[model samples]
Target: MWLSGAMATPIEDYALISDLHTGALVSRSGSVDWLCLPRFDSPSVFGALLGTEEHGRWLLAPDQPGARVLRRNYLESTFILQTRWRTDSGEVLVTDFMPVKDRRASVVRRVEGLSGTVLMRQELEVRFNYGTTVPWMRREAHNGKERLLCIAGPSAMVLTGGNIPHGSDHRHTGQFPVRAGETVDLELTWYPSHRETPEEVDIDEGLARTVAYWQDWAGLCVDRKRYRQPVRRSLLVLRALTHEDTGGIVAAPTMSLPEEFGGSRNWDYRYCWLRDAALTLEAMMTHGYDDEAAHWRNWLLRAVAGDPDDLQIMYAVDGGRELPERILPQFPGYAGSLPVRLGNGAVDQYQADVVGTVMVALSRMRDRGVDEDSFSWPLQRALLGFLERHLEDPDHGIWEVRGDPQFFTHSRVMMWAAFDRAARAARQDGMDGPVELWEALRDGLRTEILDRGFDAGRNTFVQCYGTVEADASLLQLPQVGFLDYDDPRMLGTVAFLERELLNGQGLLLRYRSGTGVDGLTPGENPFLACSFWLAEQYARTGRLAEAIRLMDQLVGYANEVGLLSEEYDTVDGRMAGNYPQAFSHLALVRAADAIHSAEAEQRLRSTQPAEPMESSP
Candidate 1:
């Protein structure tokens, strides 16, 4: 669980469990190696995933020398995981989950002996600030029981039960044996050190309630029977990555899990990017999640409350805006990928597409019957004003390229989408706005894109104004209702993308990073979200068979538990970038829905009665 040897666990080997506010990564061997306390962006308390066990971790697995993990999976429609391990003597089960809809932050692990007597070991090493500070440990009594209190700076965690391991040599260790039909429970709760250590929770009741909570939430997902399992799991992952209290969805729980191993492409993804969050909202809203849309809308309103010109690309889970990027040189990164980063520098970059993404999501919510309040619509108007104010400014683009700004065609198209949505809102919802101006801007931008964004000779839209390179994001052209998927122009773009961006196996690159477009080293895997987008493009364009094939292929990339990272290494056959990326899961949902919609349309057309009477009439 704590790495097979000196090597870090494969990124795909980690399954995610979350309380909604934050999440933890549990490896197959039953070690919680990556967990940020309090919030997804908080300093990690257990970061052994990126470093050695000395960087801190919580291990609860068979102590036997040759115990092997037989299987692991989530309980039906829930984040509660059951990992079964087999040993020469017998078998044991470990159930791990974080209680949802709870009062405090807690993770509960229950180990039960299923068949025979098994020796189990529990290890707890608490580190603060990305494993740099060893917490001061003390014993405290609460609710007629003892709990281990660990305090380092402002963060304090209480470990209860499990006959908790005793600290020896700065690490807590305990070995206990259990026979068939026996169970043991261990819990860790985090809170501010200033607050009184919270009272212990009822593990049995909490476990039952947590299971019920996740099951009920999952039950809300719109069933897509074609790819039901992956769709449901992806929806669950989206929910898991969202902050329960704030409604802010983080891109991923772990940060600095490199896009390219041993490369500086590693970036912190714990914060909420407006673009990713908006897309997530759109995905959920399309699949029977109106409440989440409302919650995220409120979060958006709070996050962008100030002057529109000052709006940032991302924010903390609680709507905090001061996210300054810094490198943590202390803990060597995952697989020795150095420069573990905190925060994201892209927050300050001008990404022209974000407003459009926000508007599109808001528009979807409106279409789904979520009425806009005074603040929400007014906020959009202000955002539109801001967009108009900087209509011609070049941006860093959606990939958050560190290179010089460029008039990215994708960003320009999304800017067009923003105005188009505004016009629709005024016409359809009867909202008071400058519809004439919005329509004019939308039409003008469409003409401009056609003129400057497309390469006539290649018959493809370039990545930016001047570059001839095709970007995978061009697959989204039809998605925003900007162009017909099968139109000659879009078809040309798709053809060019297939020729240039798609790997032989059919995965997509955001762009050839080697082109110096990103101003970073070239080595990176195909972005999984772009592949999902391609699947959507294939679906929308009536390439149903190809769409299904691509969809199935992309779904297969999910880990055993149906979790997808940001990218996949085709050559090395591994996951890349941040794990359990919200972007990837949300895109999966959209792609699945696209396939379902296209298939349904095909079936409807096939079943239609022949129209012979029209000739006579």
Candidate 2:
């Protein structure tokens, strides 16, 4: 099985919990394979996802054989995750979370007995920088309390919790039997090796504060009479993606897991994409998260404050702009896939669509009542002016093509969107500078795309002009509102895409294979975000039943933790690409919104009275 070694846990066995600063992926078996501490963009200390046991991991679970798990769910409205494992002997619940208490770095894993007596085991291993660094460790005392401080060249981690025993070769282990109501907590903290150890954390208070913080932030979601559940979850995921202190949002929580297993298609996705972050803001605004909108807006300004031409497509969570990509040969990779990577090289790519995405997101933020104050208006205007000069250029599209730049049709459409939204902003909001000329320019852009981007003979939109292949991203046309969903050409494009991009599993790939648009090795799985796009397109085009069915199927692809990857291996029915993608979560929100819309309409009609007395009076 392709998934046999590729997976650390079965798709049915994991849960995620986070502080919006970092996340942990915990298996129902009580193993944590993926977690990057200190920050979301930080190098992983527990990176079993990219490689194997040598890469680092932590486990705490019943030692009994064949312990079938019962269930797992986040504590209501919080990042605290609880997974229950029911064995013939007893029931045990494990709680995992990275606390935001005091703004210091920490991960706390707690195990509790919920039923009859059960014996549990704990294993802890520490490696730094994608498992390339082997830390020096010793058991020590901090303020007369027991702690194990593991020190690497530049980084260090201090661990303190319940009595976890230190073993040879730096591994930590603890095995104990507990009856109903017994509990244990394990805390791990990372800091600079040369620096003094962090202050002792009050585990109880930190746990309470982290839970309260997530619940409070989740309460800020903008909701209406619509798809409340998925919308809330998407909002929660977005909030989890956001860096609490700095307003940055990481693209996803992992990297090098591959869009196709054992293939070289894997690339790091741990940094912040201006485009993705901006689109997330749009999603949040739609759901009434103005405060987050404002915070992200501030983060955006800080991240791309330089000359518009110097702006990077993405950035570090601290607004750092220099992320030079590199490969890690030490870790064996997820199931020996080899050559684990860090820091995205796409930062150097000229994805023209990025500017348009930013403009559209900013426009949405402004439309949703986020006032563009003096600083904001000037920055947006400057970006628009920059686009005016470079709008005609063809660089990489939204796919971040590795080969050469092609005139990607979607890129052209987004350029049109950028100009159109800017023009709308100027005309309606009275923001100054070349509104009429930009409107004219915007119309010219739309005409250019219609002329070159569409294939009249096929009655469909191509991935790029002169290329016959269909792109899953074409589904984005209605999303960005480039055309009405019912347009004949749009409907035709949908059909062509359905014919070409649809895998047997009913999800869409980024594009068909024959064209080689990505300019890399071919044959990957259906992208989860694109699959959700299919549902959104279906819903918007009045295929409500089909849309609902497709949405349910797509959501089902999410792992047991309610976390989705960037793509799914259609052949093997497993997740691929970077795990826990923000794009996927946002798509869930959009599709759920569509499903709830139909339900609301049905309810409204059903509730109406059969007869009315109009002329009696």
Report the lDDT tens digits of candidate 2 across residue range 1-617: 12225554543355677766788777666778888877888888997766666678888878887687788888877778887888788988888888864777777878788899888887888888878787887887766777888888888998886675676766778788878999877888888888888876778888888888878877777675544656677788888888887888888887787777677777788788988888788778777787887888888888878798887889999899888888887766665554677888889887878878888888887777778887887887777777777776777788887877888999888888887888888789888878888888889988988999999998998898778888988888877889988899999999999998887878888886535667887767788888888898888777888998888888777665567878887677777777678998888887777667767777798899888767865
Worst 10 residues of 1 by lDDT: 1-10
Q: Write the per-residue lDDT of candidate 1 for residues 295-388, one digit (tens) a residue.
A: 9999999999989999888999999998898888777888878788888899899999999999999999888889999899999999999999
| Steric clash pairs (candidate 1) | none
- Scored by CA lDDT, what does every candidate get? 0.89, 0.80
Estimate candidate 2's alpha-carbon lDDT, on a 0 to 1 scale: 0.80
Off by over 4 Å in 2: 1-8, 142-145, 223-227, 598-617
Number of the top TM-score candidate? 1
Candidate 1 lDDT for residue 203: 87
Those runs of model 1 whose alpha carbons end farther than 4 Å from true positions after fitting are 1-6, 140-146, 610-617
